[model samples]
Target: MSTRWYPIYQRGGPQLRVFLPNFWLKLVRPTHEQPPNVVQFACSMEMTKYDIQNYLEKIYNIKVIDVRTRIALGETRRVPVKGYIVKDDDTKYAYVTLPRDEKFVFPNLFPENKEAKKDEEATLEQAKQSLSDFMDKNKERPNMPGWFSI
Candidate 1:
């Protein structure tokens, strides 16, 4: 059974099953130092205490001793150009406790400079294509601005 919703039994009904769930959970670095046995996770807002317990127990094969969850408010920011207000989506944070002998540390997703260089190259390649297309389109009108046409 997955985390999808199931119809509730009216009365003396059989159990229901969930076939699919699209929830996402990211293992993030803890903002504050925590005990070795405690692991912090940023999960989908729809997740509940029972869902977390089941996910860890069934998917990760980890035994959870306790679980606590809280919803964190997102920060508000102003758009640089438009000067309009924008708010990020709130996130659900879960602090899961593992067995006494177990411990967890967050892994580094990008550890070296190679990944950043690759991303820069990719962006530059796309920009070069766009510039070439613009120059070709404006070859007959040398002084035309890039945004002259729709």
Candidate 2:
């Protein structure tokens, strides 16, 4: 049987083994003050307490003292132009407590003066502008080859 589908043990079968778990967890800043050893995470909605514990212990190699989870309601907003109401997907939050001595701080993923994405966007815009200019210049000659002009 696939590792994911292994049935839970009840009638004296060997313990179920979970391999290649597909859960994802994103570290998030806590809106309120918290203990140094406690970290907040936003995770997939389907994860249970056991799943969270296993994910942290197995994937991150972090020893978890305790875990608590709760579902946060998504905000409802009105579409700017369509004047229709929209709601974002609800998310699950996990509060994981580590050993008393271990503390975690969230790192900044995006830094200033890094124009990698901006350069890519600029290139794309330039290509689109060139195509538009070519189309405009070809208005007088429908069948002329692209290389025929300067």
Candidate 3:
């Protein structure tokens, strides 16, 4: 019962090849607090709880104790100008539980750099000062275009 198409097998022909399932799983930050052993993932809508469990266990080599799945209804909104309604695609989420002793922590992907922040602030101030100077120079000609100045 596979939908994937492959070349027909024949004697002495190339060995039949196996391909991975066309399932996608995205690791997303949990909107609400969860236990350390529970990890959240947004997966393809067609994926079943067993599929998720097997995917993690066989592909990622993670031992799964339990798997819970839920579907989040997508938001619906009206187009501001056309008066038409639009709906977003629904998302399926999987909550995987590992062994009691295992813990999963989301890593910090973006770390703030104080030095870079200070440099950005300094550049903003300089731009502000130059704009103020330009305004002061054009105080006498309110209607003059900024590009007219040197």
Candidate 4:
């Protein structure tokens, strides 16, 4: 399987074995509110319900109760500068239901509020320090013109 080859088959052939399963399962943030046991995922378009179930159960070790999938149509828009219309690629969305006792909470990857405040505070502190240092350096030359320097 790693060599990317398939063995020849005879009339009575041995069962084919799959050594590697290269399926990608991305954990996507839910668009809307969902039950605690339900998790959203953006998966390969060719994946089936059985494939998702097996993937989660075997790879992730997450026991899934059920799986539901839907194809989201890509938006079509007309280019503002060009006179042609463009369409986005379609996506497949999967909603996996875990055991009722299980819960999944998506973590906040980008936290803007706290980071922005901390950044603003840092800049304010930096400006204050620079101004204080400037005043200290020119303590004895206060009467000089603003633009004049030694």
The number of residue pairs in model 1 that clash at the backbone is: 0
Q: After superposition, how far is residue 45 of candidate 2 from its true place, in Å?
A: 0.3
What is the model-wide C-alpha lDDT for candidate 3? 0.92
Off by over 4 Å in 1: 1-18, 108-150
Q: To one decimal, what is the Cα RMSD in angstroms of model 4 from the true structure?
A: 7.4
Q: Local error of candidate 1 at 138, Å?
A: 32
Candidate maximizing TM-score:
3
Can you give the lDDT of residue 61 in candidate 1? Answer: 88
| Native-to-model Cα distance after best TM-score fit, residue 69 in candidate 2, in Å | 0.9
lDDT of 1 by residue, 78-149 (tens): 999999999999999999999989878777777779988999999999999999998888888777787795
If both were scored by TM-score, which would come out higher, candidate 2 or candidate 3?
A: 3
Model 2 per-residue lDDT tens digits across residues 25-79: 9989999999999999999888988899988887779999999999999999999
lDDT of 4 by residue, 3-64 (tens): 35666674676876666765577899888999999999998887889999988888779999
Q: Alpha-carbon error at 88 in model 1, in Å?
A: 0.6
Candidate 2 pairs with clashing backbones = none
* Candidate 2 CA-lDDT value: 0.87
Model 4 score (lDDT)? 0.86
Give the candidate number with the greatest lDDT.
3
TM-score of 3: 0.82
> What tens digits encode model 3's per-residue C-alpha lDDT throughout 1-150?
135877777689689688868898999999999999999999998888998998998889999999999999999999999999999999999999999999999998988999999999999999999999989998888888977975
lDDT of each: 0.86, 0.87, 0.92, 0.86
